[model samples]
Target chain A: MMTTETVNVQDEKKSAFLGSISSAFQGAETYATLRKSAWDTLSKFAIPGTKTEAWKYTRVGKVINHSWMKSHGNSQINLPEIAIGGLRYVFVDGLFRADLSDELTYPGLNIRRTGENAENNLLGTLSNHQGDWFEALNAAFFNDGLVIEVDKNAQIDRPVHLVFFTSEENTASFSRNVLSLQESSSLHVFTHYIGSEHSTFSSVVTEAFVGKNAALKIDKIQEGNETAFHHVDWTKQDRDSRFDITTVTLKSSWVRNDLNIRVAGENCHSSLTGAYLPSGKEHVDNHTMVDHMVPNCESDEKYKGIVRENATAVFNGKVFVRPDAQKTNAFQQNANIVLDDTATMFSKPELEIYADDVKCSHGSTTGQFDEEAVFYLRARGIGEVMARKLLVEAFLADVITTLSDERLQTYCTEKIQQLMHS
Target chain B: MLHIKDLHANIDGTEILKGLSLDIKPGEIHAIMGPNGSGKSTLASVLAGNEDYEITGGSVTFGDKDLLDLSTEDRAREGLFLAFQYPVEIPGVSNINFLRTAVNEIRQYKGEEPMSAGDFLKLVKERSALVELDGKLANRSVNEGFSGGEKKRNEVFQMAMLEPKLAILDETDSGLDIDALKIVAQGVNAMRSPERSFVVITHYQRLLDYIVPDFVHVLYKGKIVKSGSKELALELEARGYDWIKEEVSA
Candidate 1:
């Protein structure tokens, strides 16, 4: 039998970690409840892995086994550019920087720092083992997170950007955030993961709750240092609502983005798109799960990758339609262009449906540029290098067009161009 | 002028062109008529410096340089062009961009500066008009989603843009309708000049009617078995390739 002392050691360590996260909060009652619940859950479970079906390809064992991961331990981080134009919220080493935060409080918008309650009915009751260790660790140790509530009938035209900045050398950080939108509300929220050149692990788990008849547009852009190991898990959603999520991952030594979305209410629409350009020995993995649990839902997903040099890319997309989810329409396509023979890509588009009436399709392809096309271009007088570059640009241009923000689209296009030449 | 002496070539260890020889003056138009497997297309591909065909024995002289020694793109820059039987479709690259890169590459090979965007666009408009290609298609991806006839016409458009000294039409009329054949041939005819030459490879005598050749040669078993005036194409059209096979084997 395992002694209580053995379990208490683990619980004590978890509480110590939770203590660091609690320093960010102000209120007392909510902080005490969240700290107790986080400690209790951390005592019960360890990190999950391949035995967990949803995390089959995205391994979190290496992430959890690294004992260096802590709560960033009172270290001061001088944050970089957090705001682009309109809004900016900076987090230093996973701790929200209040001085750097802007207070443009407006109607129908409520922003507060809230702690997770020990006995919240839906948020903390169940363990999300669905095979992500980082997500489990985040749920177990997340003491404080942002709570965003968009009131009913509110339409926010300006984009809300969530900037997550962490720069710690040889130290690991774990952070969590949650956003909730009420009925008939609409807004665009952007999340950016920026870090410095450090041997660090930044595990972030975000949950978004979209009420019935709401609309939300989410863009998650990751620009971490090449030496950082970043794993981000997003539990985003649409419920009788419209939700769009786009991620652009440009730099990282090893990065895994796990995105899970559900059309929990009827007549919902969701679009998920991502573009990743990985170079050198870097590895970028994007795993997506879009569940159409209700009827009359539509989802479209397109992910493109440009892998050069010795970079490796993995894309696994799954769409599930429950038995009651009839008339579900889902389309998914993943295309990768590998420039060098040494570069590698593994892509799988999976469909699991129990509904009889649905239109579901998935396709995946990985190959080099067409040789005949190269010869055709060369024969017309184009040099070998210029021809290859043009073909790659043309391949990735469509995905860039999916960015609704004009400025983001232009920036990503220029980055892609520079990446191809690099 | 282009010259070929004792040219012998093989693909996949099987000889396709056996000791064939031909010569073309700068202002002449020549046609080589043969059945499906008589190596008519192989000769054009070889002259354009396609690497798949092995030259067992051959000497091709284009102006003052040896043709076979250069790469495919190098031969292209040397003013040799082959209008493919099936033009390759390059997705994503616009036709204008493709042509501009090709034109600039050739210019660079000649020790000239790159053409400006304005000058290149002007050249594209003028040349596209020669083939009646839509300006919209020129702005779209190269040959992607184009019809069979449109692809062949685009080949002629490229040939006109390059203004090569020697243009080899390798079965350019194979899959074209009469209207498309005439349009492509008209584009070729417009590019003809006293300082340029042509080699038209075809199976039917119909394309010969539009671009009449100064000399006609019958190729059989990889060699030119007979050479004559334009009337020989008419004679072969009347009597089939069976006689040429018999004459060559005999």
Candidate 2:
């Protein structure tokens, strides 16, 4: 009876905590009906515990137990220069900052703030909020975001750069974005997240649509400071379309990324690649899923990480092929290197194929540095530390080379080197 | 100059080199021929500071420094090179990049500036020609995907580039055809100078035909039992190692 009473009291406390967060944006004009329903779904479920199969290796107590205040826009902080030249957009505390951003006008592109486009129906269509705490939270309270639409048969020459800056203590922010590419269109996007040295939390959701014969590529870099970041990306590809994304996580206190891609049409191609380095008690988790709903589609995924100094990294990748998805080809691989004895890595690659005529493969590997390679390098007059560094760089070369932009590759490489020596 | 006095070493608590003694002067090539498991390669490993083998008792002096006290890389920076019988294949590390790093590191140890890019490339071109190494092979990963002959030639090419004071070739002529043997010998001969010395360790005397040695020594049961002029190698070749074993036991 005592245990039962304690469980009930804990449930009450969790409900009260979630209720307080939801009441902040009562009766908001952006997706009011959808937000109302999402909050209802969120209130029905408690925070996931360690027993949850999807989150067995990751602990979320640090994120859910805090009393976080909503972040207000702060436009006073200095912004760093953009690394690559492109049409740039800046978001501060989940609010778009036009003063710090480039001109939004460009050829063959339509860009708008969520508040400006009240008739847009693509915001809440792709991402599902049912039975998902983070998704529900993001959908119910996202204040403002960007909506991008590429014209039909248009080829955009310049890439789009989006920067999100958070500079507050004990605050939380939510943002949602949507990208729509018409038939035979092509575009590239780069996203960067920067945080100040204060305890903060942020959640971002992106819904993308790839039309027939369209091509879309995205590269993301996350640089965090005592921050808990949650990102969800839902992308749908049409017939003869191509979708590629590469995510590189440099630093963060805690991070959880969910990438879901659905092949809704035939002859579509999807490629996903990522590299992460976590040290100093940091925690990073990446969960990816690719669903094949039609015939004649291909999907490939590769993620690599280096864990050091008591850090933890978790990778779970799944590929699903439906009964009608005949002639589907899927491949997934996860590789990691644990640099310290105290470091931890959990990797699971799973495939669930219901189609009779499909080819699918998955692999996971976790290991330490090759001692023979180290000795060989040291034999050639290279120091012990430099030898290990060279080997680490070589191990990550393949993953980084998958990026389509050379400048982004160089930037990521330089950032990794800096973090390694730091 | 190199000197080894009463050297004793062990691997996994089993003795390999027992009370071995030798003296080598500059401008001299000494060939040490021995039967299988006769501790020829053990000497090379110990001199190169391989921690796998523990030196139980030994004193080695190389150019006025206690060679055994230094680390492996320090020994290399101090002008000692070893052309391993089986060169390591290090994928993803370009040959030119690795050599440049090595050259810069050695220069830094001697309080010198790094070599300019143009000068470094020129040096690479000039030295790689000594062994007739293909331009493509010179730019590829170190010893990766190379044939047996290419691997040996790469070792000699590295020896030429580093310009070490003393180089030990451990069974470098073992798996080479006649054509490859002549090319490897030519590369080594071109690097011979009064300021440099070579310790050529081989199981056969066929290599001695191209790169002539000043002296030949017979090592058996971890000890040098016979020392003579170059004719000793020929004698041992004509009459297999059985005669040397009998002579040592008698």
lDDT per model vs. reference: 0.76, 0.87
Q: What is the TM-score of chain A in candidate 2?
A: 0.95
lDDT of 2 by residue, A113-179 (tens): 8757574798888787765667888888888778899999999998999988887787787888889
| Number of the top lDDT candidate | 2
Query: Which tens-of-lDDT digit does each residue in B179-205 have in candidate 1?
Result: 888899989999999999999999999
The reply for model 2, stretches above 4 Å from the true place, is A1-13, A25-27, A356-359, B235-239
**iRMS (Å) per candidate:** 1.5, 1.2
Q: What DockQ does model 2 achieve?
A: 0.60
What is the DockQ for all candidates, taken in turn? 0.58, 0.60
Model 1: how far residue B104 lies from native, Å: 3.2
